[model samples]
Target chain A: MGGATFKGGVHPDYRKELTASLAITAMPAPAKVVIPLQQHIGAPCEALVQVGDTVKLGQKIGESKGFVSAPVHASVSGTVVAIGPYNHPLGRKVEAITIESDGQDTWHEDIKPHGSLESLSPEEIKAIIREAGLVGMGGATFPAHVKLAPPPEKPIDTVIINGAECEPYLTADHRLMLEKPNELVFGLKIMLKALGASVGIIGIENNKPDALRVMRQAVEGEANISVVALPTKYPQGAEKMLIYATTRRKVPSGGLPMDVGVVNHNVGTAVAMCEALHKGKPLVERVVTVTGEGVARPANLMVRIGTLVSEVLKACGGLKETTRKLIIGGPMMGLAQTSADIPVIKGTSGILALTEENVDLSEPSTCIKCAKCVGACPVNLVPTFIAQAAEHELIQRAEKLHAADCIECGCCSFICPSRIPLTQWIRLAKADILERRRQQQK
Target chain B: MQVLYAVAALGGIGILFGVLLALVARFFAVQSDPRVEAVREVLPGANCGACGYAGCTNFAEAVVGGEAKIDGCIPGGSETAKEIAALLGQEAIETVPLVATVFCIGDNRMAKDLFVYDGIQDCAVAMKYANGFKACTYGCLGLGNCVRACPFEAITIGPGGLPVVDKEKCNGCGLCAKACPRNIIQILPKGTAGHLVLCASHDRGKSVTLACEVGCMACKACVKACPQEAITMQDNLAVIDLEKCDDCGECVAACKPGTIHPRRNLPVAAPRPQDQVAV
Candidate 1:
């Protein structure tokens, strides 16, 4: 269809040309891999393997009792050197399994294909997806199975493959769309079948016409599936935004995509699902776009899950001499990394090293009643009022402003003329509000 | 004559407004208990939410409403509790005075600086810059976010670039605890005899040594030396269970980096070095 769009999004300079045309290349696995147990947003997985144990590739190293959590497996056949807290990309020390690879690249004997999609039931597909430990590869890292298993009351009728890749400077999804459109379509069908959805739509940003053409040709014969091009905008690929853009359905406040009978998955996540069910492979490696002005080379490389960010940076010919900010995903919403010692987890979409010029490290100034942030907020919450309440530690006032409804897309911070960190304040307020509610419950 | 007529009309309107205000007050007045006022008179009036209420007035109402105990005013200690108990015909409960303490010992001079973090002045925002500026992630960044959060102006940034809590002025409102991004500020029972571990780092020995000189290396020296069995090794950090602690300074002496802080200003030496040896 034509360009479907969302509301209240900023037009960030999508610097995708750095790696959009480049093909995905395989980066050599590092000697050691630090697989964090708490990769997905849920209860941390308990370590199933211990130090000094020889673990085969694809062997489950960590498993969680919580349904919201997914099991973690060894990306490489190696010996567990340590099972302790390690620095994670999420800016905290988390329990991780550090394994020293034997360089054998051996696969486990249990790694066998599960055959065609026609044979597996929806429950069986979800079980396989869970066992393979697939999560949203689009920087969210939400467990894939959890999204697939919507409540019986909220039956998802449509599944949308999110190939928008709206975040600037991230072309992993773009490269996937170009190189493996068939796999993307196959993965979407698998998800749709698992969700028992009749209609499956792949929503892509119009900026990538090449991707749209390739995806269109891939799903041309499938009547139940279609390709819809979305106008390029920040947060367009966000679950709610994408649902709104394609299907004209607005996910209610404090609700999931399933609330409007829709389920969304990243293109990378779809590819991983196809590999899991069809090839009997697990989510071990993902396509990571290592690009920025600071890097000597800008290309998308298929990287192992537990590889150190330093290794990937080295493969990109290392950072420039004036490199300053090392962002994990995109400059807009990505985390500013302090150290390169963290390993690439399931959610690392892009590794950017912005030089001194690319980064504006200026301090925040006073807010001048501009209301620019109010109009730019994708969630449409009064960001400045919530920020003020949060700054003054007025939890009651912030609660009245619906601080918990913030999606934290960083739109307010990006569009602010005063350069105030409004989104961060809203984030803090949201946490405080949730904490207050939890304490009151206790 | 015209001026007198205008003045007379305005006076008639003013008398009517006064009578209307009196009637509105009589109808809208909340019939609160007389005990609420008596309890509030004895309250500390700090409005420090130590009792989990909104303010002293709210705490007073709760006490009179039978929703709260008379001893809920933490800053008032037992004296105000006794007064409120007497007013409410209840027993006064004893409470230990509490004060906030900065738990991180890695100050500006000691902690390693991985990068020059010149971000927003907020500790929470700065923490978003890779957990914090201090190489020791658990250590306080010493940016004075606590000073800004203190409602009573009880905390100040010391010369060491660390938050120094004035125990006398701190009322254990837990606002500093809320303000701290690293959660280094803790409300501890105020006592001169009690000791505290001044570091929050749980990093392993090598990493801790690399990050900060005074970070707790989890050596368990204090745990082994404590005679009262108060200190325990938890999550690779030394946690003192204050209930069992009797203010013995044994663990303080055993600590090598001087991370264990014995209650200062007390005569902990028992006898002077010169008096015992030189004499």
Candidate 2:
């Protein structure tokens, strides 16, 4: 299929078929949920409610004074059981609020429709979105309001909705597109109004033609909005790549989508935005894809935010006995969890359980000068050279090679003939570089 | 006659270049302090940057230029300090000998791990993943980053998955302390007879009991029993000030988890019998 795509990216087995056709099934509010205070890529929120305080669904429990942070709401009407460090999907213990469900399914009093989309002004729409705690739900978890409010100098002319569910064994975005195309389009309109942008484009991979068709029909009457089928490739849904695929714009190195007069949001984020604007509902629930050969029943379930992964897995018939690796997202870029006790935050898109057959445990062999990793790097980095430099702790050399630009997409590791963990090495180098920069700044 | 001509021509060119090189060498000669070379010669040539300079040469230059202390060479200790001072016609400030000490005693057998870490074999890298899959967040990761960072081969992973510092080999360069992500390794004065706390866990008493067998629970038993009042509770951990501690062994006895021991009793003081025999 002829469609738009960026430069270099690897094509792994797209095992999205397990949950792509499954309808979004609503998993009941779990008996207990662990809501981490810091779910986005900014300042962590401080807990507003203490233990033993009864909270309602959509009640703001955590908020930060920092401008870059977003508020966190209770996913269920429940009593706050604990407020301390808990396991988060990002593989760290963060301050979280544990709540035992009241099982009332009661909405908060403040949750009410503001008005029609046309009735709300641009400023009001942005305010609504900010208060609703909406973030990029495609696992990046960047606060959405910050993206909407770029500096006055960088004017955004186009907004692209990322529907490229490109990662292997993830179909959360695909199912959302097929089920809620109108809400996705309406959400795009609201964003366009908020940013005062003229054009809206929904970019979907060619593998999901049904979603592409439905989205195309959803935007039939709109003049500025269009649906562009992207060539199926890993990381095509990445902000930079998606901007290029949809608008032929190149976001510069170490730059954001706003640098190229564009902004991108995930399909799940758009639907969440629609709910936030129309229903005044906060971000308390999200669709999580639980699938793999190790899962007894692979499914796409509408999981409550802060629900434990163990409970989510249980709702999907639990993990098989042979399951060895439990990942929080897709296999390529997801964090391999050590236990099933982590909570599902806003960024969690998939919970994948891999059996020992898929979990490769062999020690990484030495690189034999094969440039397969170089060919597969989506950011065009020499993975072997960076990995070697990182291995030797040559932070300066790694920095010189622009290791900070790596998106940590795991393309190099997936395509390496030697099974070298190039991505992990690069990640180390990147972390060291960032730490060095932080020290220098101090 | 032809052989004579060829030899004369080649010899003329060679002599001309030789004279030119000599002239260049004389004209572009660099003026350096003679004591810098002498000081560098006396320094331990490890170039470990323990002196806060680039290497031995740079440190020696700094010393000669009055920009660095005469006792800055940590690995060379007081002997090199005296030599440097003598070369500079100054009195040497006696450098105190120091050795590294790994504080945590929670090894693979004593400390429980929350999960098996199966990724990059580096402490810093592992610390970023779920704050390390260790039950105690402040314990040694046993990934051996310190062992790799030690230029003198002073550190090694012991049989129980804890770093053991060889006091004789360690020169208090503080490289291992800097390389450690958990900040559990510390530089202590050598031959100081004092009681040392082996556990660095700042966890509460209940959590400490659940996580490790030898972790400090901050029970204040040592604080109450210390004769010199050397022990104090800080952030759910008991700290013993060596300057005040007199190797009384009372605090060691009072420690419920057996986390405190006499400094000489640690394996770090002397693990090799052959070195002791020679001494």
Candidate 3:
């Protein structure tokens, strides 16, 4: 169809077949849940419930007091057991509220279905999204309302729906498309209306033919909406990449999609919006794909946030004897966990386990300057140079090489023949460069 | 006549350019604080952001603007701090020279292996698998996160699969300590004799001994043997107060497992033989 796409992207083995065909199942509540305060990108929300406080499911347990934070909600009806430092997925102790489940699974009685998206105004929708504690479900965990509210000068012209489930070994978005296509379409329309945009485009990877067909049919005859199938590749769902692939536009460095008259949201985020607007549901649960060679059975499950990885593993027929590594999200960008005690957050799309044979623990080799990382970079950045600068502690040099522009899609590390940890170094460089800039300002 | 004509033409062109430049400079001139530029000129220009600024220039501006103090740059050492203090017309503040130290004593022999790591060699990545292959959950993963984190090439993975810091090359930027997920790397005072505790694990005696052969058991033997009483047990970890230490090498001899040792004038600790190591 001669669809628009950006240059320099790679295609990795998408092992989504392990659980792609499975229907979404509701996971039984875990015995205990550990809800971290800092689940989103900005400041951690302050905990409202202390030790011994009894809370119901969907109750707001943590409240956002800052401009760039998201509130936390209780996923189970339980008593707060502790509120001090607890083990977090980011490898440090953070203030987390531990809840001992009462097994009642009772809602707070205020969550009633609002019936349709047409009833809510843009401001009302934004308020509901904020109150529901909704964040970007595309593994970014950015506050959803903040994305909706751009500065008055930056007028958004186009709203793009990112249906491109490009990461390998994850198909939560694919399942949503096949099952909840109408909800996704409704949510897209709501987002476009809220942004005051006249047009919307849904960019789906060509790999998910069924999802594309279903979504295309759902949006048929809608004047302001269209669906475009992009070439299958890793990180096609990244905001800049999606904007570039669909509209042939380049978002400037250190700029957002809205800077170029566009805004993009993941399909899962759209569905979450629909739920928040229509069903009056907070973001307590999300679809997580439980799959890999290490599981006895693989399936997609709607799991509550703060549920333990061990609980999800148990629901998916427990781990096989050979299960060696547990990773959160897809294999490409997922963080390998220290233990199964870590809780699922809004950004978690999948829980993957790899057997001893499937797991790659090979020692990293020296870079051969293959420039595969360059070819694979959707942003046209030179990852190897950034890694080199970071290794030499030349952070300013790394910034000059555009280390801050790295999206950390794990494309460079994934495609590198040398198995060099390019993304990790770039991440460190980005952090240092940002900190340096901040310190300069202060 | 031709020479006169050429000279007149040249003179006319020069006059025109001079007038235009004056007009442009007068119209587009930007008014900035002269003190900011003056302070920037006096800075060490390392732009290390140790002063909590984006760069040396930014730090200079902040200091001139009264937003920051004089003693900000750790990488610049005390001399740079004194220069900055002089530029600000403030009394010079005394500063300590800091250095990075690897707290883990877990080598191949001391620490047990979980599995053979063959993937991307990064402590952060290695730490994804139940705290890497090290039997001590708190020990260094030896994937060289600190090596990668060091901007000065001060830290490197030695032959024993543990990080070794070169004190001479270390700038004490504290980047390695922050980069560590296990938080084993520490920035301590680079003492006069460069002697300090070599172990960092806070685990109790038996568990520490079981996890790694060379781990600090917190037996307090060193604390008792110190004539200056510089060593104290805090949170089950023996911390040697550098201010009180006299560098007598008494703690080194008193340590039963040889966890505490002098950084200089000590025999090079050899790596355990490969065949004797367990997978």
For candidate 1, write residues B1-279 as lDDT tens digits.
999989989988988998999999999987777888889999989989999999999999998988997678899999998888888875432266778878876766667777767545777777776667778889888788889989899998876668888888998878999989888998877876678887888788778889987788888999999998999998888988777878888988988777888656421212223432210
Model 2 spans > 4 angstroms off: A43-55, A61-67, A78-85, A93-99, A438-442, B1-98, B166-168, B188-197, B217-279
Better of 2 and 3 by TM-score: 2
lDDT of 3 at A135: 83
lDDT of 2 by residue, B1-279 (tens): 999999999999999999999999999998877888888899999999999999999999999999998889999999998989889887533388789999998877677787766667899888887788679989999899899989899998987778988888998888899999999999888885988888888889999999988899989999999999999899999998989988889997888888998888884321223432211
The TM-score leader among the candidates is 2
- lDDT digits (tens) for residues A326-407 of candidate 3: 8888888887765787888889888899888977666677889999999988888899999989877899999999899888
How much is the TM-score of the A chain of model 2? 0.98
For residues A1-442, write the lDDT of model 1, one tens digit per residue: 4566666888878888888889999998789999999999888899998789998889888999999998898999989999898989888889999999999989988889999999999999999999999998998899999999998999989999999898889999999999999988899999989999999999998999999999999999999999999998888888888888899999998888888999999999999999998888988999999988999998899999899999888888998898888889988878878789999999999999888887776768888888888888777788999999998899999999999988888888889888778888888889899999999999
Angstrom error at residue B227, model 2: 8.5
How high a TM-score does candidate 3 get?
A: 0.76
Which candidate gets the maximum DockQ versus the true structure?
A: 2
Better of 2 and 3 by lDDT: 2
Q: Give the runs in model 1 whose Cα sits over 4 Å from its true position.
A: B1-32, B35-107, B116-120, B124-131, B136-140, B149-279
- Chain A only: give the TM-score of model 3: 0.95
